[model samples]
Structures are given as structure tokens and as C-alpha cells.
Target: MLSRNRAAAARSMPGEGQRSSGRAAQRLLVALLGAAVGAAVAQADEPILPIPPAPALDARKLALGQALFHDKRLSNDNTLSCASCHDLSRGGVDGRSSSIGIGGAKGPINAPTVFNSSLNFRQFWDGRAASLEEQAAGPVHNPLEMGSNWAEVLGKLSRDAPLVEQFKAAYPDGLQSRNIQDAIATFERSLTTPNARIDRYLRGDKSALSPDELRGYQLFKAFGCVACHQGVNVGGNMFQTFGVMGDYFTRRGSVTAADLGRYNVTRNDADRYAFKVPSLRNVAVTAPYFHDGSARTLNEAVDVMFKYQLGRSAAAQDKELIVKFLHTLTGEYQGRSLQQADPLVARRP
Candidate 1:
């Protein structure tokens, strides 16, 4: 009876057209399965995560903060603004190896990018400033930076009727130092860049990343580079010694007080040469790299990382591929590509 029923069902089945359609569907299913497995493998090896878009902020406060950010009144000399070191038009950095402050005084360490700094667990290379608000206050009062006290700054701001009015609209206390810090910090938080090709790939767009970029990402993880550089900000959530496998400072020669890194803040020997891991977002544009800015190009930076941090050597091709992946991390700022805003240094051979 089973055989008879099977024969009847076969007889009722569609002709060659339906059979061909079924075969095609099966092939498609197999192809999809293969792609899914590939993607899963890629994900398992991916360590760095994509940055999310900036959250909605109060427009009034953001506007006020932007004005204050560009206003030179914050500096004692009236020649330097917050924008002097952190140039919004140049990848949120001044493009100097070490930033120049008031009266042409150079800072001890390299200035990290201001973009997406709020994502960092702690501010500054030494992690001295706990939050963006605290970080904002550092340069303003530092003898080398803006070189002005709150009294001087507020006195200048108070003279400007428009700025004072804007401050009143943004803060209940108006032009106080705390309110200024709050406003600048809020503006910094809004500086996040999202929607990079790598981010799109992370969001499940299979075609977003090229074959080289995907390979580079896998290699980046396999090489243990991800251990220190994981999470949304890539490398900002924790602190790591600059020279894990080698004496980087000694080799570089010229170890300054800034090179003491987190040791300066903690005063612990264990924290020697330890610095807060900087975010890799928009890194391609924000060079020269590292706390000292020793590496002038991305290729050179990758080499330095492998030698000092990873203690592992990679082939030149592999290094190039890794650099390619890094390039994909440059995202859009205000609906435009960020790389276009800054002129990158020429690549070294």
C-alpha cells in the first residue's frame, strides 16, 4: 500500500519545469549556507567592533559649545582656542607630532584626537582626567596650553553680550566655569563618526568589506592585536604598557617625564610606560601615531606596534593588508567622509 501511494504521488508531481525549479532552489540554499558559514568564521575572528552613531544632543547647548570651542577668549593670549590644538577641520587634531600650546610651547605628549573621546573610559594618555569635562579643563588651565584661569576666561566671556546670552540660554548658571566645561564636553560627545565600511560589514552587509580588508581583519585578530584593541572605541577602554615585549622608550632614546605615562598619575612602578589605549576610529587621518608621535605614517606605525607591542613579525604584504583594514575605519562626520578633511602624511616605504 505504501508503494502504491508513492507511485500515485509521483504521478501527481509536476513535470520537468517544477523539477528544474526545485533544483535551482536547492543550489541557492547551498550557496547561502556556504556564505553564512564564511560570515560566521569571519565574525568569530573579528575583535574590533564598529562605532555606533552619535546620540541625539541638545542643539542649543551644542551650538553654544561650538561657539565657545572656537572662541579665542578661553586662552590668555587670545590667540589659541580649543580649536587650536584640536582642529575640527583636520581630523580633530592639529597635525603636529607634539601639540604646540600658548607662546609656542610644545606639550610633553602627543595630543590624541578629540573625536569620539567620550567613548574612552578615561581621558588622556596617562588617564589623569576621569571624564571629558575634566579633560576639557586640563588644557584651559595648563601653563603650556590655554594658560588661563577660570576667572580670566569668564571675565572675557562676560564682556561678550551675545556669548553671555547664549550661555544663559544653555545653562541656568550662565557663564560659569562648570557650565563652560559642560558645554565643551557635550560638544565633544557629539563628535562621533559612524557608518564606515567596516561598520556596515559589522551590521551584516556582506559586500561592505573587500576581500583584502576581511583578510586583514582576520589576521589582526589571529595576531592577538585585538587583545588590547577590542570594543566600540577599539582600544580606549583600558591601559597597556607601551612596551610589552621590548623597551620602547629606551630604544627610542629621549625618555621624558611624559613617557613615564600612567606612572606619572599613579606613581606606581607597575604603571610605568602604561598609557590609556587610544581609540582607532579615524586613525588614518589622525597621525603621526602613538603617545610620542614617533611613527609618521600608518605603515610605520603598524611596524612599530608589531615590534614593540605584539612582539610578532608579519610579512610586508600582511602589514599592508592590515593598514588597508585600518583605512576602512575612517567614517563620515556630518554626512561627509572624514579623510577628506585632513591631508594625510605620505606613506613611508
Candidate 2:
């Protein structure tokens, strides 16, 4: 009942001919009808849905992946790692306007949080990577990021016999670049953040949201923010032009190539300024917002969205309420609230 998506509902239903009979069957039918009615009501009222439980993953692969994620050997200089930019303990981001990479090089775009990244239809702000495994390989070879090739990375990683053993334990063909990517991606898939206050409310716990939060949610929908930021990940399922209603780049000034978003990937004129909508889960802590990392706070980001994306202005009270709603999107990670994690202290080179 937490999801209105038919595919999600079908996935949770019992398989094949498992059924009840007689009074049990009749009672089951009644219960199901009631649930269906409730689900319908919820569907009409809410577009966003609760994150499902993490999929069961191989423990060995998960452990190996996490190790690889933190190992600086993946970088050419042995001074940077996946965790350097995506800090799992700190909302899965490094908390910079743009990421600082190996050898003190700076990346052009803000690093999107790795949390709930698996739910995104495509990886990266431009939607260039089709899967997490592919995305994993990007930074390692990016000149401004890890700045390493698989040959160099494997050569360094091979020196560690213990790490090689980890590879052997996790994959049939061990210590290969593909396996490393697989292991890292497998670990990343485990980073889903669930059980936020909105999730509880969506799951039929009416008291989960305070009156103000509820009002904020109502305003979020009424103001059409839900048009782009809906579904399970609450914004990752699709792509939209950054300035759907107005010219955000010109107004902001000094637009760079990164501001082109999907246009860089497809080289399509229509794709200019288009980007994959980022997930809002744990968004409160994953600032500053947007690919440029221009917004310093949620309020500023919301104001920008209203002006450039919605082509409208909101009442100050309405905007404030919407910010309150966004705060409720922060959820738990590994049985702990994400808010409990320390904010990213910028690590300058």
C-alpha cells in the first residue's frame, strides 16, 4: 500500500496459485478489497512513494565492494578513492561546490550523492552512464577525477595479496577490472535510505507527519513541484530541462559546458540544459544543490526551481512550508538517521 505503482504492487504480491478457500477466501477477498480502496485513496492523494527494502545482495561481494570503495589504489596517485567524493557517513557526498579530485584537481560538476543512486533511471547529472557499474568506471579514468586507467589501478591493487584474496572470494574470475566495478556497484546498491517520516505516512501511519509538514506536502503538490519530483526516488525517474519556463543559465551568468547537461552526452540541440532529475531522499544533507552546486540552502534551490522550472513565484509562506516538507525527506541509513552523520568538512588540496 505504500506504493501506487502497479509494477511495485505486482512485485510484492504472492506468486502463482497460493490461495485461500471458503470463509478464508471470502475474508481474504474482503481484506484485499479494503487494501485496494485504501491504496486507491493514497494514489489519488500522493505521487511520491516509500522506498522499498534493499534487495538481497551477496555478502562477500558487498564486503569486497565496500573495501574497494575506500581503497585509494583505485586512483592513479593512490591519494583518492570513491569514498573521497562520496562519503557514505555524510549523506554520500563530499559537501563541496564541486568535487576535489586526485592531485588537487577540481571536477567541474557537483558530485551527486551515492545514496539511492541505484534507483535513478540513469547515473550522473547528464544521464550519460547507463548503470552503476559503468558509472563506477567513469571517475577512475576522468582526467580531472581519479585520473587512472584499469591497467594502472589493477597493477596497484594486485600488489595487495589480501585484496586479491577478497576478489577471489567475491567473484569466480577474480581481480579483474570488471569484478572491481561489479563489487563496487553491488555495495552501492545497498545504500538505499528508507523509513523517512513521509514513508511512514505513505504506509498509512497518519500521525507520522506534523500538521505543518502535512501542509507543506499539500503545498508541494498544489504548486506542481510534484510534476517533476515524484515516484520512488522522488525525482530520479526522468529528465527535464533545467530552465523549462525561463533561461536559468543567462540569469545566473557565466554558464560553462557542464551547464549544458544532457546536451554534452547526446549532442542534441533539444537536450541542451536537460538533466536527470536528482533524487530528493536525504537531500537535506546533500547540499549545495544542483549540478553546479550553486544553491547554498534548500530555500534557495526551491526559489530557483519556482522561477526557472515552474515559471511562477510562490507566496513566501508557501515556499517556507515546502522547505519544511523537503526536510522530512531525510531518512535512515544502516538503522541510523542520516541527520546523525557529520556534515562534510571540505577537504581542500
Candidate 3:
């Protein structure tokens, strides 16, 4: 039954998901997958944005959260907010090699984009938090990150009459740090970017993308880049090592404390060097890439991924085309109004 399903899916799915239209694509995909892709091709039909959109944002709540996301007051020394690392205008990343935490502490890891982050299986590099609410509270409490103890942060929030009143209204249980985190997390959940050229193409608009973008998409699949980087988020649902068929960490040298990666969370040797794959949406805008932000240019990041993750190299032409296609992945936040209009956002001081 599975074989028949796969065979049928393969014959029908072409170019995004069609038959007559994607003969070339189907042929290429079949060649790349070597039969396995045929069976699971149907699975690819699923949209990547499974994350339920945040409930209609309460303006005061999201405004409050947005303020907090950019609020330096949440830091011990009033130096950093979520925006310090995850700047939305810059593709939701700050474009730094490593994020500067409280008191100018340089973190060992790159600041992952906050845009569309809610789609991940788990939050953070280590997959520690299970939900956005928990994840939002993480940085503030991280000694090196925000450096603000939740209790102290709560105390400060309590002092802000406007913030307190909004919080009170949002949560009948009354304002607390956890509630604040949930509100902010909800706001973050609304921070989704959609409608890239690829999206238009996926939705059956062939003219939405240029021919170069289409070729890049072909190269992306032909070279098997989508094996792990598939789905609506375009790569957040799975975890893989930096080097599957290569030695990425070894190439970099001795594993630093921060480079322990998933081992720190999983405490398993097999998990060493493993990290959750990041989303490619807005990747062109989010430069200074990777877990540690070692790659400064998107081209360099693509080169590194070719060498390490996919275990293959791209021809110069193919590389250029893929990079060009990658630019199309950048899109506008689909839920910005929710965040900006949330009562919580409006209510924040």
C-alpha cells in the first residue's frame, strides 16, 4: 500500500506539487531521492506552518511584549532587549558573530532569528524549553543573556502602572512573570513571515518567481538540500549534526564549552555537535550565520552548508542560482498586526 501510494504521489507531484507541470522536477526529485523520496513525496504536501497563529493579539499585550522585546530595562544594566539580538528589520537577527549579552558579555552562540521561531519542535539551540512562553523567559533569566532575575523583573513590571493594569486585564489571575512570559510568547507566535515568491509558487502562481529562482529551487532539491530543510518553516522541525558526512567541529578545532551544543541538553555522546536546524525564511536578511555566527555572508553560509550538512558541493552557477533563490525566502511578517495591535502591546509603557 505504501509503495502504491508513493508511486502515485511521485507520478503526480511536479513543480511544488503537480503532475503535467513538473515532469522535469519529478524526474530530478526521483533521481535525487533514489526511490525513498517517492514514498514520502506525499508527506511533502503538508504545509510547514503548522504552528497555530497566536490568538487575536490584544494590542496592549503585544505592544507591551514588543516594548519588552526591545526593552533594555529587562536587562540587569539596561543594555539589551530581545531586539538587541533578534532585530526584526535585519531579518530578525542582529548580524553579529555572537550575540552580546548583558554587561557586554559575548555569548558563544549566534542569535537565532525570532521570526517564525514558534514553528520549531523545541525552543533555543538546546531545545530546552517546550513552548514559546518558557522560551521567552529564558533570556531574561540567563545569567549571561538578560541577567534579570524573573522576580526582579516582575517587581519592575509591577511598578509600571500602565503595564500592570494591562497585565491585570489580560490575565484574570493577575500579573506575574510567567503570565508576562506567556503574553510575550504569544506575541512572538504572531511574528511569522510568509508570502515569499516560493509561497506564491507553492500556491500555484508560476509567474510569482523568476526563472533563476525556479532553477535555484531545482538545484536545491536536486542536491538534496530539502531532505532536512523541508516543511513550512523550511527547516526547524528536525535536529542534525553540523557534519553528517564531514567533521565540522574538527574543521573548526577544539570543541569549546559553548560548542558542546545538544550534548549539553541531551547528555548523550551521539548528540554532540547536534543542533536544531534553523529556518531559511528571511535567511538572506539574517546574515552572520550559523549556531556560533561564524559565517558572515549568506554565500559563505551556503558554502558551509554544502560542505558540511549536505555533504556535497555546488557548482559556481548552481551556487549563484541557489543564493538567488534563497533571497526569495525572505518575506514579511504575516502576523505583525497581531503583535502591534495586541492590547498587551498597546498597554506597555
In terms of TM-score, the best-performing candidate is: 2
Q: What's the true lDDT of residue 19 in model 2?
A: 46
Candidate lDDT (C-alpha), each: 0.86, 0.89, 0.75
Q: How much does each candidate deviate from the true structure in C-alpha RMSD?
A: 6.8, 10.3, 13.2
Q: Per-residue lDDT of 97-182 in model 2, one digit per residue for the tens?
A: 89988888989999999999999999999999999999999999998999999999988889899989988987888899999999
Q: What is the TM-score of candidate 3?
A: 0.80
Better of 2 and 3 by lDDT: 2
Clashing pairs in 1: none
lDDT, candidate 1, 1-349, per-residue tens: 9999999999999889999999999999999999889876876666767786688888888998888889888899998998988887778887778888889888887889998898899999999999988988998899888899999998888989988899888888788999899899889999988888888898679798899998988788888888998888888999999999898988999889999999999899999999998888888888888998888888889999999999989999999888888888888889887854232463221
Arranged by TM-score with the best first, the candidates are: 2, 1, 3
What TM-score do all the candidates reach, one by one?
0.86, 0.88, 0.80
Q: How does model 2 score by TM-score? A: 0.88
Which order, best to worst by lDDT?
A: 2, 1, 3
* Candidate 3, 1-349: lDDT as tens digits: 9999999998775555455557777887879776456434533563433233345777767776777787777888888888888877666777677777987787878888898897778888877788898888888988888888877887777878987887777788777877778778877877887666677666556797799998998888888888888787889888888888898888988678778778898799998888888888777777667787777666787889899888876688998898888777766665332122111111111
Candidate 3 local Cα displacement, residue 2, angstroms: 62
Candidate 3 accuracy as lDDT: 0.75
Worst 10-residue lDDT window, candidate 3: 340-349
Error at 35, model 1, angstroms: 14
